[model samples]
Target chain A: MNRVFITGMGVISAIGNSVAENQLGLLHGTCGITKGTRLSTRYSGLLPFGEIAANDEALKEILSVTDPGVTRTTLLALHACKEAIADAGLTGAQLLSPDTAFIGATTVGGMCLMDELYNDANNPANNSAFAPFYDCASVNMYLQKYYRLSGIVNTINTACSSSANAIMYGARLLRNGLANRVIVGGVDSLSRFTINGFNALHILSDEHCAPFDKDRKGLNLGEGAAFLVLEKEADTNGKKVYAALSGYCNSNDAYHPSSLSENGDGPFLAMNGALKMAGLGSTEIDFINAHGTGTENNDEVESRAMIRLFEEPPAFASTKSNTGHTLGASGAIEAVYSVLNLVNQEVYPALHFKEPILATRLTPVQVHTKKQVRHVMSNSFGFGGNCSSLIFSKAG
Target chain B: MFFIHQTSCISPQETFSNVKMDLLHVSVHNKLLAIEPAYTGVAVGVLRRMGKASRIGMGTAMRLIQEGAAPDGLIIGTANGGMEESIRFLKQIIEYHEDMLAPGSFVQSTANAIATQLSMLTKNKGYNITHVHKGLAFENAVIDTAMLLMENPGNTYLLGGVDEIASYNYIIEHTAGWYKKEYTSNQDLYKRNSAGTIAGEGAAMFLVNNKKEQAIAELTALTTLHSTDKELISGQLKAFLKKNVPSGESINLFLTGENGDARDADLVASCESAFGNETTVARFKHMCGEYPTASAFALWLACYLPIDQPLPEHMLKKQGTTNKNRTVLIYNYHKNVQHSFMLVTKFK
Candidate 1:
């Protein structure tokens, strides 16, 4: 089988603008959660979220977006894609190659634009300006158009596991000899829709989310975009290697629409499948990025799954405590954080970890610690019992 | 080579059980809507949180997996994943402008929610993927499943195609004038010379595996055509057939997509002329309202057509004298934009 390698990565989160900045934030244990400045929400004062400081116009300016009617989601995606392509050392001249493809994952594509259009439809004057963003057929179409790449372009929207799935699919396509180099990641912008959606489920935390803590409330809604340029291990450029995505598995809970199984069966199967694919055992894993959404059901269920899988669980923490849950972009953003952990040789603390859950007896690493981490397993489970786990190993 | 072991569809026509031509008996005046089974029986939480789209997706998914054990992979396709909830959430945004928007609807608005909900409902812990490619939404999903099977043999995968049309809002803007202005019945769909057909929604699921079975359809070959040129389409079909089928044997049945659109109808006519009298012809769009993965419903029809004794009158374009049902061809072209073709042969 062919080996897939991470050649380059680009991330735009609340923590920092570039991969280096994000790494610094992770190292210093700086939390990105803050009061909303861009999104005017009813819970702005009550809730802390991992929202990007820049507005849509600034993001468009950063990407040099000529089209005025581009969706905020698309702008964020293009901004990250531009950085990723450049970080991979494959820019304007290099992207002309036909062997490259772009695979993106987004939960809602151009939805913010749609919301604006719908709002403007009542007034005929604003309708003309919002017409360009009305095409919501496929989110990948916009990315393909912007990148001007003639290769196969696709998007996967499997909820929170979306970006992880995109990365997994990119690796598979490369292994299957479909493309030589591929850009894979996810992007989502904070919308009233998602903020209120998590709120409706009563899973949105008004205060700073406490993952794996006894007094945990719920998740904080965040939004951003992240991408990784994946290439064959043998064809790596001169850039510093972060980590290689070794194994990935996606599964459905089939238990309920909104809740996971009590035994964490879905997550267990996904983690086991990923481990088996990577040819690693429970003892081989050094660190785990748990999908601790700070929700009562998710933390407990994930802890139970961990206990059932390993005799001595690996050092693990839910970065959601620091970055908040970015929904569709959570998987890719967390994967980037996992790669940073492996590259930096450190385990970032799971913010606000208190006593272990009474039922599972699992406690996450609460403080930042330097360690000889080799392999890191990241988990992203979303609504609809869609559980996905990706195992990333340091490139030796 | 993932063989479609079992397939089931709950559409407007009587397509769930033994397939025959009972679709013509469906009143043309009355819009042919799916005779939905009780959602509470299939979905555990249908009583509390069942939305229109989730209910349809979960219902069809459960029916597809009912006969066998849970699949190792689950993939779903939907153009608008949860537009019903999305529109609802959008309405909340409009009503409240920006304050106190309902989060439940917002979360469900993501296109991948259907797959997520299905996974949660089924507790399936395998490869879960969802694709939305306009008209080729389901076909892309089928292609993905095939690719996965090629890589991992002996693995079972559940592939489902589902979409729902909310009463107003998003559909009006997204689809525009795709549905008839006046409520035209399903029976009149073929007779009425309209630019678009009546808008409808449904969900269909198929359990496919690499293992051969007595009652199965070997999905031998699948291809897609981006262009609408009839000559190019014919050439692609001939090349695909030559690669998959025996040299001299002709396709037993050629199922063509015959939506009410004139251009699509012409394309189907060209296909019928290409096959001539050597193959039987059938059409399915009139039965199931036009949607992206309506081809999935057609594939379901092809799976049961051979086993069922009598053919339904509504589906028959040209009745064949021969009774041999060995191979079936499915060709679907959506709005002269996206074209997909599949070959399914009865397993010995």
Candidate 2:
């Protein structure tokens, strides 16, 4: 059996632009959620968001991408991919090898430029360059084309669980002997398409999101990207191994398109299946990074799910409180956060939680604490009832 | 080994499990609309609210309900997923000035909605994923499902690829010169020798199981290449067929993605030359039109075309196929970028 280990992690969220910065923000309990300024939405003034501080042009400048017409989603992905490969110490030759795979996920591909697409679609004579990037696979395709990566590259769009599935699929690439190394993650930018859609669903929070809270109103929309480099344990000789991705599973609630079953059958099955895959008992999981989207239905259902899985419930927190719900990138971002805990043997607390949901009566870790974090679980549930869970363990 | 126990396709042609010769002509129009089945089972209320892409996918997935236990994993691939709903929702937001917007269209606009709907209908709470890579979408899903089956044997898997053709998407492709400048019929798709190919949409579902007894055709290998060089594609094809194809016993049938575009002639010619004259060549894109997942439709076609079925005059390129059909290969590529290969053998 091939043992997959996480060699590196890179993330850029509302909380921070790099892994270290993000970790510092997590430690200080700093929240990046605020009224949106970057996205061009009419409800931006009312809705809180964990939006990236930089615009597309500035982000491209930071990434040294001079090519015109590149979308913000692609820029965010490239930034994260660069950091991940560099952190993994992957050389240019290694990246060009057929043994390397790149799997990316994104909910807001080029739809971030919905206006451009609409205009271009309405007037074909416009010859809009953004039209080429309107497809959902644009970000991954751009990454693959830019890096000249010819391996088993794929783009996943299972809504929020998109990146978690990407990571899981990347691990399978190594486990199946299809590739020696894989860079897996996802990116999603704040787009009117999603904002209006989520707003229409009445789940966009007007204030800072309070995950796992009884009085939580809704979720703060966010935009970001995160990536992790995974390789076989045997292959990482003297490489900085962060953690072991021991378990991963994706299950669907099949009950609703945007909402989970009241009982969270999807999250339950995903969490249980992940633990089963890791060959660990629920008690062994020291902490959990809950999906807690801060939505009324999500918080309560996730709380009930935790109670059903953990006898006493682990010290869990929804990092979304800090970065809002990053959607497709949340899974990978939280996966990186979970690994940081395993590496440093500490856990961060969920923010803005005044009281627990009455049903589960469960409260998340409310303060930053240090402990011997052995195994951590992260959950990402997306629209279409697509639920995914991943368990990462401490590496020697 | 992964055997396709059951399969269904909602294609432009009347390709629902079995192929129909009717409506099997080249589509002159840019869009080749799918001919859907009147799927029973699953409530009409639930089906009515779903998007076209979701409905097509669910219809295909529902056909495999009686194959066995609930699938351990469900994977779907789509290049342009739920676009009708997406466009509708976006249009509503812009048209209504972002006021009084309904969430129904937004909820159904996601790429994985079909997978979620199927899971809910079947109560199968297992691994579910959706791959949305362009051109390589279906191959990506198949690769994931196949690799998972190798790791977890005996676990039945439902793998599918779905896409839809919308007016705006058609226009987008047309503007990009992805559609023919002059209208060409499906039969004359190969003869058009134009700059663009026709657009089509459909869904293909395969119940992949490890058991050979419950198999229609044993899938030997599925490989994809991300390169534009025809020589590289030809070289890789040779290596792939060498590993999967037996010595001396050449492939009896070749299903090529020869959507009539003079630009792709080099690739089509390269593939034709790679397989010796002994291999009988056939093409599928003309019948179903051209889409990212058209190769999946071609795959469904390859599964049954070798069972002593008379080849259509338009489908055949070279005759003289061996009577003892054993191996069939499906090769397809888009523009010059992504190339995919699938080998299916006659289930003995």
Candidate 3:
């Protein structure tokens, strides 16, 4: 089998602007979670979020987007894609080749724009003005138009697992000789729709989210985009390989729509499948980026899955406490962090943990520390019981 | 080659359980509406969380891969996924934009919820994919699955397609001339004198494998075209059949994308004329709603036809001798935007 390597990565998260900024934040244990600024809500003062410290106009200028009414989601995605393209040192001409493809995953493609447009009584425009932001075609069409990428461009919206699936597809494309290089990632912006949706479920935390805490409440919402340029190991020209995407799996719980199954069966199966693909065992995983949403249900179920899989649970943390739940972008953002961990040989602590949960007698790593980390696992779970786990290892 | 081991579809037509050639009946009009059963019995917890589309998708997917062990991969296709829920949320946003909106509806609005729900229900976590490319959505997913299976021959994959038009949104969109203004009844679907077909909803699934079996259909070759010309479509089909099938072996069944619109029906007619009366022709869009992955339901219909040999009245366009079902061709389009052709033969 051909080995898939991450040659370049780009990220725009609460931690910092670029990949290096995010890495620095992780190293210093700087939490990006703060009161919401971009999104207006009564919950703003109560609930903390991993919000990018830029308004829509400023973000547009940063991304150099000319369109006036582009969705915040697209703005975030273009920002990350630009950094990724530049980091890979690929020009628009290079990306236009038939051998190059774009696979993007997102839970909401341009719903943010639709939300704003739907309320626009002043614009009173027809479908032509809003046509570019209402459908799935616009998402890829705009990206391809901007980048001039003519090859296969597709979108995956598998909820929170969207980006992980995108990465999995990108790797498979390279491995199967379908494409030589691909850019895969996910993006999502906080919207009134998502905030209220979580509020209706009563899962939004009023205080800072505390994953795996004894008295954990719920998750804080976030928004960001992250992208990775994937290529065959032989195709890369010694661009410092942060990590190898060794193992990945997506699974259906078939248990419930909104809730995970008891005993963490879906996550266990996913982890087992990914490990099997990587030709490794539980012991090989050095650190884990838990999908600890601080929700009573998620942390409990995921912790049980972790304990059942490993003889000794790997030093793990739920970065969601620091970054907030970025929804669809969480998987890709956490994946970037996982690669950084593998490259930097350090593990960030699971902040705000006081005691272990009763159901699963597991305690997450409580403080940031340096370690001889070789392999890292990242987990992203979403509504409709979708669960995905990706394992990345230091490139040999 | 990644072969289709088994397939199943739960649509408006009587093509779900039976596959007898005679049981497959042709519709009298161009658009056929699905007769939905009570889904309360099929899905339990997932049903509560899903809208009409995801429930049908999950039900059909479970039926297709039930006989085999859990699949190592899952790929789903939908043109406008979770739009029913999204529309509902949109309405709420307009009604109560200042209030806290329900996150459940918001989360379910994303198209990927179908795959995610499938994963949570099945606990089969290998590789999950969801594609949304309008008319070519299902074909893109199928191609991806084929590529994945070709790379790793030992693994099994679940490929599924689903699309739904809920009543309120259906009526609202129909007012915009999305569906035929005249064809209101399901019984009058296949009549040739309609501008648009009635909207419908259904789901189909197939368990594709590299290992051959008795009930398998060898998916020999598949191609997609992005053109509207009848001549080009016919040429592509002819070339594909010529390259994939053995010499002198005529296509036994030609599954067409006859959606009752004058322009699209003419395209199907031109292709039928290219093949002549030698092959038995079939059309499924009348039974299933016109959506991106409507061809997915047609493909599932073709896979099951050779097994049970159903002669349902809704499936037949031109009757032929009910000899053992052989090569079946699925040619479908998404409103002239995307064209897909797939050839599948019953494995001896």
Candidate 4:
């Protein structure tokens, strides 16, 4: 089996529009969660969000997107993917090679245009221009077509863990000799569809999320896109290797559709399985990027899972405090952050964490500290008990 | 190669168990909705509220378990999952102005709801995932299942594909000319050289493992292509067959996806020509209608067909009697964009 390495990474979240900008925010401990100004929804002014600073028109202008009915989801995905491709120095020929594949994940999909879809669905006479881009596969299909990619292409939608599973699937493809390299990641643009959907569940935080904090209320919905160029070690000889993707595992809780078990059985098994796959002991992990959606159930459950996994749980933090919950994009976005931690040998503070949860009595990394970070384990648990843990180690 | 230990389906045809191929008849309809099976072992309260996709998916899993197929993992593919609930939630949000709305529809609107529901019901919490690519969704899940079996040689996987026709999505597709202007009976689906094919929905589940013992069929090869050029797809399929099949081995049964759309006639014919003239060729979309994951239905049919018996008369596009029906090759394309090929053989 061939080892997989991250040759390039790109992200555009509420924190920043590029990798450098995002790294700066992380280093400076600048939280991106704020009152929404870009998204046009009833709750835009009522609730907090990690809304990208630029509006749709501005994003289109920057990306040179001229397609009339293109959803913002596609634009954000294109922006991040373009940077990742450029950063990896992948030419059009490399992208078009049948050896390279694209795996995209998304929860919102074309519902980014929720109002328009509703209108078109209700009116028969209206020619639905966006109909072609509404399916979960549409974003990846658009990317494949845009790049003229002739390789294996697919999309995964495991909700919050969608992108994490995308990364795992890509690695397996490379290891199995199905593809030489894979551009794997996810994108989700905030829309009324998810906003109202999450609102109905009463998990949307009225204030900025406080992950792992005692008084944490709920999660704030965010939108962004992140992509990582994963190449087998043999193919990435001369490339700039960000980190080696050493381990990944996907386990289901089988307890509930939207909630984890009281014992965090899914999370514990996922983290434990990933460690076993990497052939590493629990203590070998230097840091952890917790899923920590800031909801009462997630924070507490994740905390308990950590305490169950390690003799002394490694220093951990939740960047959802920085970017809100990007939903489908959270896994990849946090993955990029986890890789950054290994590359920089630094850890960022979880934003609004005041006190540790009473049950686990675990306090997250509260200050930006330069540490000897080696192997960083990133956890992403989604609705439907889909729990995944990915371990990224320093590339030697 | 992965062995199909068991199969279940809730489709337009009565294919859930012991499919009577001889008694089957051609049906007529634009919307080929699945003929739901009895939820014999399912809880009544949960069955009352489950969506069509979930009911059929969970029902098939329950049936397999009762027959002694204990899958350690669950994976599924759907082009549009829980779309009915998604539309309902959106409509409610619009009507209520996003206030005091129920959470049930919203919770079920996610694409992975069916797979998660199966996990919750079965408590088989090993590896779970959902693939939502359009035409290749089911194929992607199949690919994952193959990899998982190779990685852990002893494990069994419950793999499935599911999709349902929701009015909101159906209307949007209809307005976009994705369906025939006139209602064409599925029995007459190929008889007419029309603009569009009928819309259909179904769920097909399989218990697959690496062990060949007691296996019904073996999946030898699977490939997906993303291209609009028919020539390119044909060349790729030829190459795929050359790489996977041994020399001089003949394909006995060739299943083709011809959804009765006039524009796809040339492409469909071109793909069919990739096989030898002696290979028995048949089409399936007429029976199941046309949906993204309808190829799952094709696969289910491939496993159930007897090696010695001839295919039902209505399903034959071209009949050849030279070879026993030991090998089945399924070729399907969606809207001339995504195409896939699968090779399945009777397990020795």
Candidate 5:
């Protein structure tokens, strides 16, 4: 079996615009959660979000995209994709290589352009530019067309676990000899559609979220994008390898639409399956990057699941406390964070935590501390009981 | 080879359960819907919250699983998912100015809902994924399933595609000239030259496994091309068939995606000469209508007609009916850009 290796990574989130800045923020326990400033929403002032401070115009200027019809989702995806390819030191020909696959995951593609969609849907004009950008695969298609990539290009939308599945799929392509290198990740931007959707579900937090805390209010919606360039171990002889993608698995709770079962069956199975694939035991998992959505249901259910799997449970923390729950981007974002954990030999603290949940009696790592991290399991659960767990190991 | 262990499809066609229908019954309106069954054993709480695609898709998936197809992974390719819910949510956004949007519609609006809903129903916590790439969506899922099966030989998958037509979207596509100007019944779709085909929606799922004992059909080859060059298309089609169907044994039947569109007519015209006069040629879109993932219905028909029963007289656009409909070739070219060729052979 071919071993999948993460050669390069790029991320743009509320906490930072690059992987270096995000690492600094994580080390200092800086929380990016705050009231929304850029989104044109009714609850922008009342609800807190991990919104990228830069506006759409700033992002466009940064990406040098002149296409006005390109949505923020596309812009964010472009930013991360460019950085990932650059970080991988991929040549121009490699970008257009048939052996290079690009898989992007997202729940909100051009749908983030909600206002434009409304006008186009009402009138049905053939000249409507927004119509072409409305499909969920629009952003990925834009990347493929601009780069002229002929490799296997795909888009995955399993809600929060979306990018995790994308990463897994990319690895499978490499394992199956379909591609030699895969640029796999996800991107989403703060928009009225996502905000309103989360608000309507009554899971939007008014203040900063505290994952696994007794008084955890709800999730603070965030927007960002992250991309990781994965190559097989054989292909990375001299290239800088960050970590090995040890194991990944996706599972569904089959319990509810918006919430998980009280027993946390989906999370448990995904985590267990990923570890089994990685050929590791619970005791071997040194640290866990818990999904920790900070919602009342997610924190309790996840904590109970952790307890069930890891008797005493490993030293785990939710970076959502630092970066806010990034929806579809959370999994890949956390995967990067877990890689950073193995590389830097440190554990980032979960912010705003005071007491443990009554049922599970589990508390996250309260403060930033140095640790000997080996295999880190990153969990991301999403709507419709979609749960995914990824295990990353230290590269030799 | 990836074999079809079991399958189910919810289409406007009279394919309820394992029953049979002899002929096509064209609907009065352009938009045709799947004749859904009464969903039983599903939790009422879950049912009420599901979008239309979720209900129909889960029902189809459950029926296949009941045939003892235990899938370790769920992969779905839905081009337009939960259209009604997305439309309602978008309308509310326009109506209420982005505030007070109903949570139900928003929850079900994501493209991932199709596969997630099925996984939730089965409680089979496995590899669940969804793809949305317009015309090439279902083919993408199938390609991925084949790759996954190749990587892990014994592993099976529930790979399928689902799409729905919402009224708002119907007006958008219909008014934009994606549908025909004249109201032609689906059965008579090919009689008149038109700009667009009638719109339809359906959900089709197949349990793809490596077990030859339970194989319904062998998915010999599935290839997707993104180029529009007709020369490349014909060349690739020949090479694809040569690899799967052999040189001497040409295709027994040609199940073409020949919707009423004139452009499509020009594309399918090559098949007439390419396969010679001995191959039976037919179309399934007349019954299911045209959509991005509409080729999925063609796959469902290929699963049945060649292996189980004969095609209806109305469906046989060209009569090259042979004694044994063993080698079935499914070809679809969408919007002149995406082309997919699938070769399915009867399991003997």
Candidate 6:
């Protein structure tokens, strides 16, 4: 059996721009959710969000991206992917090899330029350059082209759980002997299309989101990207191994399009399936990065699912409480965070939680604590009942 | 090995449960729209809210259900997923200034909406994923289905690829020089010798598992190339064939996804020439037109085409009369960029 290990990780979220910065913020218990100052949405000032500090122009300039009509989604993805590739010390030859694969996930592909798409669609002379970048796979396609990657390139869009599935799929590619290395992650930018869409769903919080709280209102929409370089253990002879991607599973709730079942069947099945794949017992999982979208339904249902799984549910926290819900990027972002927990043998606390949901009455880790973290689980459930769980273990 | 137990397609032709021939030579006016089924099994209220892709996808699912199949998982592929609803929602956001917007179009506009709808309708709580790559979308879904079924040998997965053409999407692609300048009948798609191809839309689904019993066909080999260099692709295809097909064994039928675009002729020719002249070659894009997942229609055709009968005159692109088509190879590429190959053989 092939053992998959995470060789490198890169992340840019509302809390920070790099893995080190995010770790610092997590240590200091900094909350990134605030009234948006960079995004151009009408609700930017009217509602709080986990908006990245940099604007699209600043990001493009920082990344030296001169491509015309490239969306912020692609820019963010390129930013993190570049970091992950560099951190892994992958050479141009290695990246260009047919043995390397790139799997990306994004919900807001080019819709980040929602106004532009509308204008071009309505204009009689629709010679829009952004038209090519409008599809969900355009972000990955751009990455593959920019990096000159020649391996199996594909995109998965299962809403919020998109990137987790990407990670799992990348691992499968290695285990199936189809690829030697894979760059897996996801990205999503703040777009009026998604903001208004999520707003219409009435799940946007006016204030900072409070995950697993009795008074939790809704989730704060966020924008970010994350990528991780994964390689088989046999190939990581002298490479810096961040963690081992031990197990992963994707399961559907099949109850609703935008909500989970009351029993949290999707969440349970995903977590349990992953554990079974890892050949680990429930008690072996030291900490969990809960999905905890701060939504009324999600928080409670996730709590019930956790209680049902673990006799004494492991120490868990919702990083979304800090970065807000990053949508498509949350799964990968949190996976990186979970790897951080295993690497540093510490756990970060969920922010803005005063009381647990009355029904399940579960409390997340409320303070940053150093612990003997070995195995960590991260959960991400998307609007389409697409739920996925990934478990990362400490590597020697 | 992955076995296709049952297959269903909602193509421009009458290719659903009844694979009737539409040999009228009727011309498609720049676009080939799928001839949708009645969908009488679904409720009127529910059907009213479903998008065109969802309707075709669910209609196929219903057909599979009638055939007594309850798949445990679903994996779907689409290039332009629910674009009709996405464009509508985007237009409304711009028109109404994002006020009083309903979530119906927004929910259905996602790339994974068709798969989500299928999962919700069938109450399938198993593995579900959606691939959105341009030309290799369905091919990637097929790969995922094979991987999943390989991991869980007994589990049956509903694998599908669906793409629909909308006015906004078509106009954008047309403006980008993806469609021919003059409106040509689909029947004359190959004869036009034009630089661009006709746009098309449809849905194709298959119940796939590891079991060979009662299977329609077995997917033996699959490979995708992401290069424009013909020599590189040729070398890779030779290696793939050498590994999958027996030594000195020739492929009986070669299905090519040539949609009458002159720019793609070189690559198409390169692909077909890989097989010898003794092999019978066929094309299906004229019937289904050209979309990202149009290769799926070709795949569906590969499963249903009669084994012993002579080739349909309209489907034959080149080569001799159809012999025993026990072994088939489906070769397709989109705009000379994403190339794919799939080898299908009889279950026996």
* Candidate 3 or 1, higher TM-score: 1
Best by DockQ: 4
lDDT score, candidate 6: 0.87
Candidate 6 Cα deviation (angstroms), residue A10: 0.7
Clashes of 1: 26
Residue-level lDDT of model 4, residues A266-297, one tens digit each, is 99999999999999999999999999999989
lDDT of 6 by residue, B1-348 (tens): 598888899988889756776463354678888988788677898788778988998888777856756887889999887778888888888888888989889988888888888788778889989998879999989988888877888888888989899777777778777889898887788888778998888999888888888999998988887878988887787888889989878888998888888887777777677787778988888888888888888888888887777777888877654486789899888867788989999743
What DockQ, between 0 and 1, does each candidate earn? 0.38, 0.81, 0.37, 0.83, 0.62, 0.75
Task: Give the TM-score of chain A, superposed on the true chain A, for all candidates in the order listed.
Answer: 0.95, 0.99, 0.95, 0.98, 0.98, 0.98
Q: What digit string (tens of lDDT, one per residue) describes model 5 on residues A172-265?
A: 8898888999999998877787788888888888989989999888999888999999999999999999999999877889787789999899
Docking class of 5: medium
Better lDDT candidate (3, 6): 6
Cα deviation of B340 in candidate 3 (Å)?
Answer: 3.5
lDDT by residue (tens digit), candidate 3, B139-225: 779878988788678888889888886444354345445578663554455765767666666788888888776546878777766
TM-score of chain B of 5: 0.94
Per-prediction backbone clash count:
26, 6, 55, 0, 1, 0
Where model 6 places Cα greater than 4 Å from the true spot, the runs are A124-126, B22-27
Which run of 10 residues does model 3 chain A get worst, by summed lDDT?
A119-128
- TM-score of model 4 vs. true structure: 0.98
lDDT of each: 0.75, 0.86, 0.76, 0.88, 0.83, 0.87
Candidate 2 chain B superposition, TM-score: 0.95
Q: Which consecutive 10 residues in model 3 chain B have the weakest lDDT in total?
A: B21-30
True contacts kept of 2: 0.82
**Model 2: runs farther than 4 Å from truth?**
B22-28, B321-324
Winner on lDDT (2 vs 4): 4
